[model samples]
Target: MDALKILIIPGSARDGSFNRRLAEFAARQARAAGQEATLLDLRALNLPLYDADLEALSGVPAGALRLQQAIQASDAVLLVTPEYNGFPTPLVINAFDWLSRIPATQEQPAGLAVTANKPAGLLSASPGAGGALRSMNFLRQYLQMAFAMVVVPQQFALGRAHEAFDATGALQDPRAVQSVETVLQSLARLAQALKTA
Candidate 1:
């Protein structure tokens, strides 16, 4: 099978976000396993709040266009989300809101062409025991039901993420490493299978 192209998106944009560290670690692991992985920095995208008035006046922002193109190019996506009071961060939600508003063109078959049927892997990290799992659950449901994305059943939640990674940004616990690896492997397998199907 060919190497899967994976896009890793971290929900948090904070300077020292545990989810960001997890995303970076996942990218490295994917590359080491002979897959192509790109870590998407939402802060760099600088996406504006999702406002229908802005869309009516200016159309989807360049950041949303770029995000659509990125998703269209990838075989699968890995969403590393942080829980903000049991919900995914507003930034990531806003980004997706913009993406969903982009109209279909001659080159694109549907408005959700970039996301529909795409394989997705869900992961989350938090200092608390929940490990942002609530946010992950919400994302999984939203992506699958709203966008028709096919999410892999295998998922991971890194609890106590503040201490999960080492100084080098690598996962400290062997079990945590194994959990991440399992999720990635399942995601790759699903992507490959779906592509062939």
Candidate 2:
């Protein structure tokens, strides 16, 4: 198969966030599988809250524009989110809100340019046993509304995520690693098929 470009986005901005670790691990795994992976951290982006007034005055922020370009360029997206009281973190929601507002261009319709028809993999990690599963549900729904082609019925939710990794930030559980690999492989295959179609 052709080398796929995959974008890994982490939901949290905390310095020692488990979600960030999960995203990095996934990115490493993707590279090991012969795909090009780019990891994007929401905190570094420093995006403003979504507002119509701000957009009307200045258009999409530079950070959001950069993110939109990254999404458009990638063959697939993997979202590593954390649960905030049974919902996706604010950072993830804010970034998507900005990305969703990118105006329509000659190449594609409004919003669709960045996300429509693109293969997406959803994963979530939490310290608790539930593994941010609720957050994944919300994320899946949001991505669907954004017109993304979500790879369903195979999402990964890493329960007890705080203890799932080693000091080197490598995933310790073989099952979790295998699940992540399966999700990445599935995304690559689906993305390739869609690209050729």
Give each model's whole-structure lDDT: 0.91, 0.86
- Candidate 1 lDDT over 48-79, as tens digits, reads 88888888898878888888888998999999
lDDT of 2 by residue, 1-197 (tens): 57889999999878899998999999998999899999987778779999999999998887877788788889999999999999999999888888788788675446556687789998889989999999999889888876665655578999999799999999999999999888888888888888888
Q: Per-residue lDDT for 131 in model 2?
A: 94
TM-score of each: 0.96, 0.93
Prediction RMSDs, each to the true structure: 1.1, 1.7
Number of clashes found in candidate 2: 0
